[model samples]
Target chain A: MKANIIIRLKKNILDPQGKAVHHALSDMQFGDVEEVRIGRFVEMVFNHNNREQAEEETRKICDKLLANPIMEVYDYTIED
Target chain B: MKTAVIIFPGSNCDHDIYYAFKKVLGAQTDFIWHKESNLSSYDLVVLPGGFSYGDYLRSGAIARFSPVMKEVVKHAEKGGYVVGICNGFQILTESHLLPGALHKNVHRKFVCRDVYLRVENNRSVFTGLCREREVLSIPIAHGDGNYYCDEDTLRELEENAQILFRYSNEKGETDRRFNPNGSVANIAGVINKSGNVLGMMPHPERRVESLLKHDDGLKILKSLVNGISGN
Candidate 1:
């Protein structure tokens, strides 16, 4: 099974990197940029024979390693 | 005092901390490699500042899993003193030994300069020698020192008096610009709930000498020594 994990900073937290990108777009004369938020995209392949079990295990992985609970929120989807 | 400085592969400030202990406090210092698992004999273990593991992926992320940290955690649980500085602070947070996490600087730049830090708490083992609210000049150099924690955790820290240091102006007033990083509450350092483990963004080892000008860093180290020696 393959899993795709999307992790991003919580909305309440400031996204300085994204803000910097917003500024750079305006500076480069591309004024159409309205918003940009930076986030992490993680793709993983799991060898579990059961798809449901694989998704559960992947969620554990997300909680333990992929995202820090203090500042980030993550969601994962498994594909067979 | 018997002190050990944990040496990671890319730790550049290990020697600086070692020297500060040896010369300033006349401490018996040992260098423990990151791969070592034993740390029972040391009165204090220091995770010095540096670009540990080249700060790959995230600052101090990889270094937190080193074999030495297992022993460090055990020692801390046993009431042993632990101080993490700069990259060391990152490792402590990564290891879950301390609360919160360090994000990229607010300015998105690596800042390296002397700044004033006010002592928030002087009763802990880390800062017993300093007066409460006194400001001292210390140097900081890091790209990801912006501290972040949830509001509840921040309240817990404040209620428990775990906050140790806060950045301030020369006159000892809290200054947002002097904060350098957008740390919540301008917190520069904090002790663990148990109050034995300390993690701070500023480098006290860098300010232990008169030649460094304003050797106020010694006040904190002296407090540690007094705590260990029961002086």
Candidate 2:
């Protein structure tokens, strides 16, 4: 199975790097730039037969190794 | 006293903190790697500052997930003393071990200079040796030291007296310009709700020698020694 995780800064937390990028986009003449918040993308390959098990494992990864709950939010999708 | 300095892969200040504990404070200090899961023997566990994991996503972001941090969280939960400095502060925030988050400096620059701090509350174990409102000069080097939390959290922090230090001038005035990263209310350091964990952006280890200053950082360490000895 292949899993793709998308992690982002929690809402209400200031995203300075994203804000800087938003400014740069405006400087480059990109019109209608509403907002930009950077996030992490992690792709992992796991051999699993059960969807529930994969999700449980992924949550552990987020809590224990991948995403920081204090500053990030993550969601993962699996493809077989 | 037996102390341990948690060493993340890119930690640059672990040796500095260790030297401060060993030579200045005359404590037996050990450098624990980030992968270690044991922390039961040390009286003090220090998360020294550096660009852990190259600070790739965010300062201390990747390091928050290090193997040793799991032990750190457990240690803090048990009322063990933990101090996170600079990147260590960022890690504590990233790990949810402390309230608030660090954003980039409002000026968008990596500031590196000595900054003055007002010891806000000396009742905690970390600042027990310092007088209330005493001013100490310490160096800060970081891009994401601006701390932010909601109004309610800030109110609780103040009400609980969890605030440990604030950025200030030599005369002890809260000068905005002296606030290197535009931290909220000029907060430089804070203890956790339980008062067992202290996270701060300033590098106290850098000021532990008389050659550096009057070794004001020594006083803080002494306070920890006193706390461990149950004095």
Candidate 3:
């Protein structure tokens, strides 16, 4: 099984890197952009063949190490 | 007093802290590797600043899982003194030994310079020698030092007087103009609820010597020495 995870800062949290890129884009004549938020993507391979077990383990990994509950949220999908 | 400075891979400030405690303060100190698990004999355990694990996967994220961190947690839970400076502060937050998290600087730039810090709570073992509201000049060097926490956690920290230091002007005014990293409430340092663990972004170890033209950092180390001796 393989798990693909995407992590993002909470909606209310400020994303300074995204903001800087937004400003850079505006300066380059791309003025239509309203906002930009940055996030992280992670890919992991699990040896388990059970879809249910892989999903459960992926959730645990996200909660424990992949995403910080203080400022980030994460979601993932599992496929074999 | 005895001190142990834990050295994670890529920790560049470990020697500075060791010198501050051993050579400057005349306290016995040792460098503990990240894989060592026993910290039962030290009076103080320090986590120094640096780009640990290359600051990959977020600052302090990877270093928090080092084999020694389990013992660090056990040490703090037993009321042992622990101080996390800069990157060390990030590790404490990742380990959940301290509340809140450190985000990237608001300007998305690495900031390095001297900043004034107002001692918010002098009653902590980490600041017992300092006068309340006294402004100290310390150096902070990092890209991610902005501190953030939920409103409820902020309220609890305030109500419990857990805040140890706040960015401020030379006169001790905590205005937004003096906030170097956009930390919430201008918080530069905080103590855990039990008052045993301290996490701060500023590098007191870097400012401890008069050769550096600033000895303000000595007060923090001296206070810890006094606290341990008095205990």
Candidate 4:
């Protein structure tokens, strides 16, 4: 099974990198943006046929290694 | 005193720190590869700065899981001295050995310049020789050096005097303009509750050599050397 994870900075955490990108887009005449917050996307390949088990394991992985609870929150999905 | 400089794959300042320990401090120093697990032989272990693991995912995010980090944690649990500079600082935070995360600079630029740092807490073993509020000039080179922590941690850091250094003006005032990175409270360095582990974004090794004419970094190294002798 393959799993995809989205890791993002918490709403209160400052996103300087995202702000820079927003500014660049605005300079190029795409000025309709109110704000931008950057986050990370990660993929994982698990050796199992259990969709339920993979999703659970991916959450545990996010807690232990993939996401830093202090700075980020993560959500993931498992695909067949 | 025996010192070990932990050499992660992309660590470029390991040799510079080794030189400070060997030639400057006249201590027996060696490099320990990141794969090694035993860190019991050394009196001091330094995680020198560089783009460890190519700063993948995040700076120090991947390097934190290297085999040696397990030993590093054990070393810290025993109250052993560990200093992480720049990228090494990022790793320490990522490993949860330190209480914060380094985010990108507010300007989103890789800042490489000398900045003034004020010693906020000089009572720790790492800063024993330094005077509180004394400003020192140090070189900081990094893109993601803005330090952030939760509100409770910030309160505790303030109440306990755990903040080791803060970006400051030449006159030793913690002003906004002196903050090269947008770190909360303008923090440049911090020590854990035990005062055994230290992580800072400034490159102290870069200024250790006399030829560099910036000897502020030596004060920090010498303070640690002095602390070991006193202990």
Choose the strongest candidate by lDDT. 3
Model 4 bad stretches (over 4 Å): none
The C-alpha RMSD of each candidate to the native structure, in angstroms, is: 1.6, 2.7, 0.9, 1.2
Candidates 3 and 4, the one with greater DockQ: 3
Each candidate's interface RMSD: 1.3, 2.8, 0.6, 1.2
Candidate 2 residue-wise lDDT, B1-231, digit = tens:
689999999999999999988887788999999999999998789999998998887788788878898999998999889999999999998888899888778878999988899998999999888998999988899988998777888999999998898999998898787788878889999999999999999998988878866677777878998888787
- The residue-by-residue lDDT of candidate 4 on A1-80, one tens digit each, is 99999999999988887888899899988889889898999999988889989988999889878888888999888898
Best by TM-score: 3
Task: List model 1 lDDT by residue over A13-78, tens digit each.
Answer: 888899999999999998998987898899999776688888888888878777778788998888
The sequence of per-residue lDDT tens digits that candidate 3 reaches over residues B1-231 is 789999999899999999999999999999999999999999899999998999998899999999999999999999999999999999999999999999999888899999999999999999989998899999999899999999999999999999999999999999999999889999999999999999999999988989899899999999998899894
Candidate 3 positional error at B208, Å: 1.2
For model 2, the superposed segments whose C-alpha errors exceed 4 Å read A63-65, B65-67
| TM-scores of chain B alone in all candidate structures, in the order given | 0.98, 0.97, 0.99, 0.98
Per-model CA lDDT versus the true structure = 0.89, 0.87, 0.94, 0.90
Candidate 2 per-residue lDDT over residues A1-80, each given as its tens digit: 77889988888667777889999999999869989998889998887767777778888987766775655789999877
**By DockQ thresholds, what CAPRI class is model 1?**
medium
Q: What is the TM-score of model 1 when looking only at chain B?
A: 0.98
Better of 3 and 4 by lDDT: 3
What tens digits encode model 3's per-residue C-alpha lDDT throughout A56-76?
Answer: 888988888889999999988
Ten-residue stretch with the least lDDT total in model 1 chain B: B170-179
Best by the DockQ measure: 3
Can you write out model 4's per-residue Cα lDDT over B71-155, one digit (the tens) per residue?
9999888988999999989999999899989988988889999999999988988888888788889999999999999889999
lDDT of 1 by residue, B1-231 (tens): 799999999999999889889877898999999999888889999999999989875788889889999999999999899999999999999889999999888888898999899988888988888887888889999889999998999999999999999989988888687788899989999999999999999998888889878788888888898888899
How far residue B170's Cα lies from its native spot in candidate 3, in Å, is 0.0
